[model samples]
Target: MAAVTWSRARCWCPSLLQVFRLPVAKLYLGRPTMRASQQDFENAMNQVKLLKKDPGNEVKLRLYALYKQATEGPCNMPKPGVFDFVNKAKWDAWNALGSLPKETARQNYVDLVSSLSSSSEASSQGKRGADEKAQESKGILVTSEDGITKITFNRPTKKNAITFQMYQDIILALKNASTDNTVIAVFTGTGDYYCSGNDLTNFTSATGGIEEAASKGAVVLREFVNSFIDFPKPLVAVVNGPAVGISVTLLGLFDAVYASDRATFHTPFSHLGQSPEACSSYTFPKMMGSAKAAEMLLFGKKLTAREAWAQGLVTEVFPESTFETEVWTRLKTYAKLPPNAMRISKELIRKNEKEKLHAVNAEECTTLQAQWLSEECINAIMSFVSRKPKL
Candidate 1:
């Protein structure tokens, strides 16, 4: 969800607020002091499901509001029309919360569930959180600490190749982070390889052939890229190992990128017979000169961490032995500063490019969707897939 804007939310709120006689101050009062810990979240959500009796409409509405706020951030959707009574009630319940921080809502959800489950034994209550549904994340693992929300690509066995589902999961993670005031920044990293880009097998195994893949891929890719473009908080990338394809191109969007000496960046868009996604077409040339951008995007040159740093593509390249510790120490220190200052600074620097980036993303997606169905792209993929691996 996008950050809640007073301008947008107020479109339907003036008369509604008057009708409810709810002072604006009421919305700000009585919020939980802190976010629910991971364990608290898991325990509360467990009890949320185990309640023997249906918590009536009022409580159910409260639950729905809290859950949405917790998982998706502020209520940014348009207010339901008066004629849509059911949805209006639901929307009103959520909108009433009024800019409550996601973390606070999470703790409130936990408190509400705990209060509801007081009659039951702890052992008998459920112990699941919505997040635990993915026992082993196919690729992405999301965690939060202090003010940093880390979205790690965890499929080291597969060189952290991205799947369609992984893209969706990442989009969701970014959305959740964007609205959470506690989340000062998003840190992306991988344990082994940063990412090898899309797993071809994920596309090949689709129900239909390249046509179906292209159509679906276009939609998902656009959504994923837009999530990055619209991300409200700082985005930081820690490149632990080599990155390929979109992984490298995406560094253009990050507020800061720290890489290990061992890390390298590569983009094989031309080799794949496809064009860029994620607005790299715009951001790349602006960050690095057009010549360097052409070398990476058009000529498919690999860039070592030090080389990328010299070209202004990477923020810093640390020694491999202390990369993680050094990068995180810097991040934690930055995370401690006043968040609004950084946010405003970032906006001032990049705000002018926002619309152009969106336009470039649209053009790229259109070209890419068309390219996906081209004979050249299909033949190139097939040729790459058919080659035998070195023993």
Candidate 2:
């Protein structure tokens, strides 16, 4: 197996700086020289797996560098090529640590993790008194009932536009569901949109230049799609309304996609000067003929629910009035199936194509990172952001 890159581990540290309200520079400069017990370091490593929020790219890079120095003593690997922006950035981050002693690096890593854990606990405690409704309204709402784990997009007001935090949340939700007692996992959104896809704010709010932003975004995206590709149980999508961009593209990975009559599927990658993601590049062409896939992905053709069903992108279309009732009724039956049998069957079906999907995901993300830094993509995103938001 290949060594896991920092990008693969990027999902581990969530909301460290934000929870503590600390500047990235200050966090590092103020690091205490106090030694931490090896047991403490091991415990911190375990705590990292439980983190559920994104702490920003700079913080992620710092954590990666410190972890590398602590474990491997130094960055001895050869630098990646320039076009391999994700690995290149990670390599540079680890290499920049110079000759820091392993013990000091371990102590620093432990301290950083401790601070993040403390701040997260403090923030949660503070929010415990806030309105429960408000808390539930933001981010993801994951519920497991009747052996079905339902992950809903709770940000209806924004048309379920996925922020960085939401992406991490969804990944965590799926991770938990995969090992749980659920027979199936479902995804849906609230309000008028199923999902409008990646929030442009994820790009705009990044502190570094486009290169850095694109690199980090690529890392997140690769892991996000991998969650779907590696999902063990039956994965279903209940398309309540309009779905665009990544949301539309990713439906190709779902075991079943039930759409409301009012739902629309669109992947306007070309308009944004981007390419297909979520393994759509391969899955679309495989499901629908190459011509139809090119029409939707390259020509930006939006499909109605019926049209999507006709093209095999959607399994079925339901009347808007009964969409939820009808879909869940069927899903409840699906949830009652023998869990082990279902998982084994799913694995057998996906096994042959799993390697292919992973390859395509990696390729798409790499291409997207380069596109994101291109003048064409930059101008397109700027123009779109400047205009009124629409689905």
**lDDT top scorer:** 2
lDDT of 2 by residue, 44-65 (tens): 7777766555444545656767
lDDT of 1 by residue, 1-391 (tens): 1223323322322121112111111122223766688688767766665565433344455666777777777888898786755566566667766677888888887776665665435422432233343224667887778888788888888888889988888877775565444445554555778888888775577899778998899888887887777676678999998898888878888988999999999888888788877888888888788999999899988999999999898999999999888988888887888665565466556666766886888788889989988999888777777772210
Span of 10 residues, lowest total lDDT, candidate 1: 17-26
Q: Model 2 residue 241 lDDT?
A: 95
Name the candidate that leads on TM-score. 1
Model 1: what TM-score? 0.67
Off by over 4 Å in 1: 1-136, 388-391
Which 10 consecutive residues of model 2 have the lowest summed lDDT? Answer: 18-27
Off by over 4 Å in 2: 1-137
lDDT of each: 0.71, 0.78
Candidate 2 clash figure, as a count? 3
